[model samples]
Target: MTAGHCSDSGPFNSDGSVSFFHLPWGGIVGRRLIGPMARPDMSVADMGFISKRNPDIGVIPSIRNTDDQEFPELIIYGTLDSDTVGSTVCKSGYTTHVTCGEILAFGVTVTFLNGMEFNGLIKATHMSCGGDSGAPVFQFAEDILPGIFITGMVTGGSEEQGVCVIEPIAKLITDDIYVLTINDPI
Candidate 1:
């Protein structure tokens, strides 16, 4: 129920230093060409056909606090343009770095700075343990951007799937939160 930006998707130390999501292969990216497709749902689970983008090096987008300092605001987006609606989409986390494994996920609508609203979702996969929060959730595809959208952060999980929630990129950026676009430094 707290509100803050993510730090990264690695682990924290009692001392300092950090471990981040090293996307040597980079993450995925998605963009809206003619705006979102008419059948947004049709593109479900078909991230490979979308686009791809990578996360910046050494910097993992997260929502953690360090030494009493909160990082900048950040959000991830897919290729679905304004025409698309944010509903019933799948997201992939770090631990289970698999293809099309995320289901039954939805994002919350947050208002942006331009008075726009965005829909984001919380990950249902228990992929993140203790050190895997802030791991970006994206889709990879050919002829498309690599990093589509950063689904959510690891808010914590239960016996079921790992409990991770994400704030929509549209919301963070529009709201004037220090946001880091995909492929940007963490």
Candidate 2:
């Protein structure tokens, strides 16, 4: 799941209609918004989905950490348990790119400037900025074939050091839907 603030604009046109998905490299990917799901109270989880199966834009389970090379593929086979704590984690996003840190706290509550309070969060030392709201937080180890797509960082704090608050993947799962993951084709 993502932070609710990321999709606050609704990804729609001024006429109140869904907008087409534009690829970063300038091409119509045929992706249509399925609508965003968020708490009216502007709580912790902010999630959305899109459908691009018609033209099959292709989904790559990878993240770009450096501008000098290709994206590093990550095989996501599972998720981190809610009780998981004191684990090393990493996140990749548009702003900060990629950062690694440790989980400092779990099942914590935080209040945003909008006066919205979110509970059951995973606080870490990872770095993130404004545009990094929806970036995936995961764990990668040497022997692990598929990393765990743990959560998404919603907010960042600590003026001197980079601290991020993440919405745990465990809390994002509902009866209707869950996050998607994939294994490397090799």
Model 1: lDDT of residue 143 = 44
Local error of candidate 1 at residue 30 (angstroms): 34
> CA lDDT of each candidate?
0.33, 0.59
What TM-score, to 2 decimals, does candidate 2 have? 0.70
Question: What's model 2's lDDT at 6?
Answer: 54
Off by over 4 Å in 1: 1-100, 107-123, 145-147, 161-164, 178-186
TM agreement with the true structure for every prediction? 0.34, 0.70
lDDT of 1 by residue, 1-186 (tens): 112212222143343322222332134543212111111121111111111223222334432212223322223433331113333323333444332324335554434233434345444444443333333444333343332444433333343434444443333233433335554654
Q: Which candidate ranks first by lDDT, i.e. highest?
A: 2
Question: CA lDDT of 111 in candidate 1?
Answer: 44
Model 2 per-residue lDDT tens digits across residues 1-186: 345565456655565433334234222564444333432334435444433434434555554445425445565665666455677788876566667778888877877666667787888875654467767777774576434465554554554556778777776676775555664452
